[model samples]
Target: MHDIDPGWAWSPVEESQQPWTRQLAAHLYRRAGFSATSETLDEAANKSAAEVVAELVDGRTESEEYLAQMKQLGRTVVATGNVENLPAWWMYRFLTTTDMLREKMTLFWHGHFATSGDKVTDPQLMVDQNELLRRNSLGNFGTLVAEISRNPAMLIYLDSVTNRKAHPNENFAREVMELFALGEGRYTEDDIRELSRCFTGWEIRNGRYRFNRYQHDSGRKSILGQEGPFDGDEGVAIVLDQPALPDFIIGKLYQFFIADEPAPPAELLAPLTIEFRENGLNIAPVLKRILSSQLFYSPHSVARKVRSPVEFSVGFLRALEGSTDQYALTSGLSELGQVPFFPPNVKGWDGGRTWINSSTLLARSNLIQSILKNKNTRFSNGTLSDLFDKHRLNSSQEIIDWLETMLLAVSLPETVRLQLQSKIDSGSGNREERLKEVVHLICGLPEYQLS
Candidate 1:
């Protein structure tokens, strides 16, 4: 990363140098969303890399019918009056949604804002907040911060549901500075105190955000060198104005979309930080720039991220065009550490290498095994064998190559490949069972844990 030129790194790749192939298309799909199916990858490879990314960034929007169906499904889940069921609802969306980048960004913001369902027990509130994140996922960062500050679920989770003028709650204020906008060390304790005062009287009343003006602290406050009798929105705007905000947010985005380790230096991120601030904090442009950049398609980013549980499982099923019981899939994800709308804590999951360990590795394997064994699991609306046959993958090597192309960010070791072939050749079951078992084994490999 240090040796890479910032200009060349960000410049769009020329076709003469990096031809838009199925493998590169797979990389884009894996990073931008869940992994794509072979068919999807083929479709993407037909166009220029810039065209595919542009379409992903600007063209994909869920149809009205799709939105209605998802809404109905969400209503049905919330009707159960159990917040526990919300994860399954979202898992369904992850598996089925056509607008992949938007959903992916929504997941990014969910971790960024880091609200949790454990405390905010109302399923409807959780669903509403999820929708809020999705709605503004690819829009202005400032607007997201303002709206989320007043979100009922966020207020409830942060213990700011009943902030009063006399004793203002500092949870949301501290988080807004330390986690959401400026990152740690960018704001002082005094700043948090002053900012908390701005949010006084902001409370949740009858499942809605309410400002009790009588309880509000209308006193002048000094925050981040700015002085004013600030309200919650104004306080948020001040925080957003801080110079550290763009670097903090863009750094996180770099980690989420690029490599997680060897954090990019400030100089390397200077271009994006400037653009993010100059563009009024609009998210789509930054995303478009990153996705289409030479750096994103290079070795530094490809296979650079450790697969989060959601990515590991969802990407596998998506790559295979497989479907399974949403409830069970949600359970598997919880075991693997991430459950949508139920992040472990305010910091959310520390992704990358944190997603891998002996325990999690085993859990990942178990989850894949469970999904394969589940009666409801189906690939291309039939058996895995049927899907493989559709793709003309008859031999073990052909199937392995296909799976590698669709599912792995890196090539499998020749030793592992040989072992898998041996297993498939010697396994004591039918062809479909052998193929499924080999895929499960491949997924357990360290190579498959990336991207």
Candidate 2:
């Protein structure tokens, strides 16, 4: 409930407690939310790992507000039958929202339980699903999965209504195990078939979920070694109780928050698993444990993952003033791969290496330049230096420092810095023109794109 204090920044630190800690925190902050500004970096670095985590949860304020907003947004959206230009909507949200965390986590859930607007074709369903994810995103994995399974958007996307006792569709059931809950190979084909039968009556009608009691078999079936005439909820319960389910869920958190590699040995996973099971699957405790863990900051984990395009674009937005028009910026993000709710497929975009291909990289470079020039979204102060100037940035050195601090918080090569200064000096322009070239260059480079 605390309003953001403009004065909040990291305390001045004399040195690193662990050199690797700085890198790990930066990586996690960017991945979990947006990119670092000089301001956010000050807030994130040199704190107890637990303190660093406070920032991730900082974005939670808008969930309650967003719930109300979504109701209005949804009603207006449905009556008009608006097929949202996904990028433009997201662009506006990214700039205007106090619920950046909600929006950001909603993004995570969209990918984790992948769906398609192409299939659902209802923006209300999409908007509704976004709320489900925001509410439960860092709350409960088990409940989140159950809610997602029942969601109208997902039901339509995965063909749940087609599921029947006589000839059940396995699409939703199979994915619940392979993709959503149990990951791969944990549940058998029979389990999926039986699970689909339990869910036979569950259907989306006029944007509501209905259970057709006459259609549901309510028959006993064996799933994960548990035998029952399990209905949808019971099927979900059986799947949740799987031994691999905790590891699967925790492993996903590891990949999302820690690293792309496998999770730590059983020693590290067991406590979080127990916390998940005991805490009614509230997710913050598990995430808190991971962020505070020594393993998270180990050298092997630092800089091991790449920023998803959304993160990259959001980071760019955060690096500037909150009022910056991101429509132009996100237009570039759309071209690169990520376009908020509009992912490339049912499986979503493969982040990490998939985000760094030849065409995508060029898009990244050009996007930085485009955004700096206000070519994508018109900027009140389109030039980067004016953004700097609005904050009263003076001197080429100060401008360079601001870019390094805000846009590229990580260390830049001195050679690159010198070359940038040379390029700026040779250009016959004011401070805006001079600093724009340097800020643009930093974002356009491979190093900026990498993390």
Candidate 3:
């Protein structure tokens, strides 16, 4: 039903029309990373769409000082034995980092290959695994999946640590096919059993991957119609060779970057699947094609993805050039059903409409309210008047227009816009305080939940 037009162009549009430039920049940032500030959007507005996409895709590395800071934080978290604090530290990084796409992709892979610190309590192990994801965030997908197979946190989380020769654990093997590589029904029950045997010797020791040869089945196994004396590495290699792998990953990328409902049909994804597979499973090329494609700019793709809690949180903070208490932010996010390193289950957050039932919607509003109220919170743009004066916005209508454009992907109705302007004009507080209330209200809007 959701067929892509074959006539769609994959080349980048040099410059969007004047008004659409900022809007498109915001959309790009929301999908590529978190949202960008007005100033950042202005900078991007001067560039071509291809330029922006390239800048996001080829992100710069973190500086040595930044690396030192992250290392110190890691050491402190390990010393305290409070692995939970990892999310708080990460929230701080998300708020302040310039390597937006790298961090954003790290978050994506975290959900894609969901492993929780809750199960594998070693803070160092979790930290190591996170580094692994970040390093390979946009690298070769086959290499990444192979590395993940041996990651210490993954081994423990998927119960592969106890997968011995006699009694093989199927959790890791089953998930590798069903969730990680190929989707359901692509492999049979016997495949899971045989794959488990292939990975039987994988274990963790001293927070690192250790292969125990004696415990390994080391037997000839059949998986994805391949028969071999396969071990964990060979098992992963066979899994990656499946015809279903590219399509499965591309479908996931669509759900993440494009619309969620009316799923992108297999027909719509065939081209991307071909490019991804033919290019040796390197993610950057596929992402470039998708982001630059005519399809990416369509109405069906824009403003269609429901914002996950992390997306919402990161975007809000980035828009205001704001900072909040990390602990409070992490706590609020957990209540909103996403806590970075602690995905709800092995399957991760079922993102899309699932992000906003009644309870979560209310919790999201309450969290924004708390952030606005917090004394520690800081917005680089000062107050509403400062922003208005800086931008020369004298009227409530103009102010509302700018705020709504920056904050919401979808436009508010005429009546609703006027109502918001009225609130801004007559609200009983200083300009900053009133603006905070305005922002709080706008953020709580149902439309704000979308990218």
Predicted model with the maximum TM-score = 1
TM-score of each: 0.98, 0.85, 0.96
For model 2, how does the per-residue alpha-carbon lDDT over 206-322 read when each residue is reduced to its tens digit?
A: 789998887788878877788877899988888887878777777677676655554456555666677677887777776666665555554444456666776666677676753
Q: lDDT, candidate 2, residue 400?
A: 65
Write model 1 residue lDDT over 317-420, tens digit each, in one string.
99999999999999888778898888889999899898888989999999999999999999999999899999999788888899999889999999998888
Q: Which 10 consecutive positions of candidate 3 have the poorest summed lDDT?
A: 9-18
Q: What is candidate 2's CA lDDT for residue 212?
A: 82
lDDT of each model, Cα atoms only? 0.91, 0.67, 0.86
The number of clashing residue pairs in model 2 is 9
Which stretch of 10 consecutive residues in model 1 shows the poorest summed lDDT? Answer: 9-18
lDDT for model 3 comes to 0.86
Q: Poorest 10 consecutive residues of model 2 by lDDT? A: 4-13
Model 1 ranges with Cα > 4 A deviation: none
Model 1 earns a TM-score of 0.98
Please state the error at residue 98 of candidate 1 in Å. 0.4
- State model 1's lDDT: 0.91
Clashing pairs in 3: none
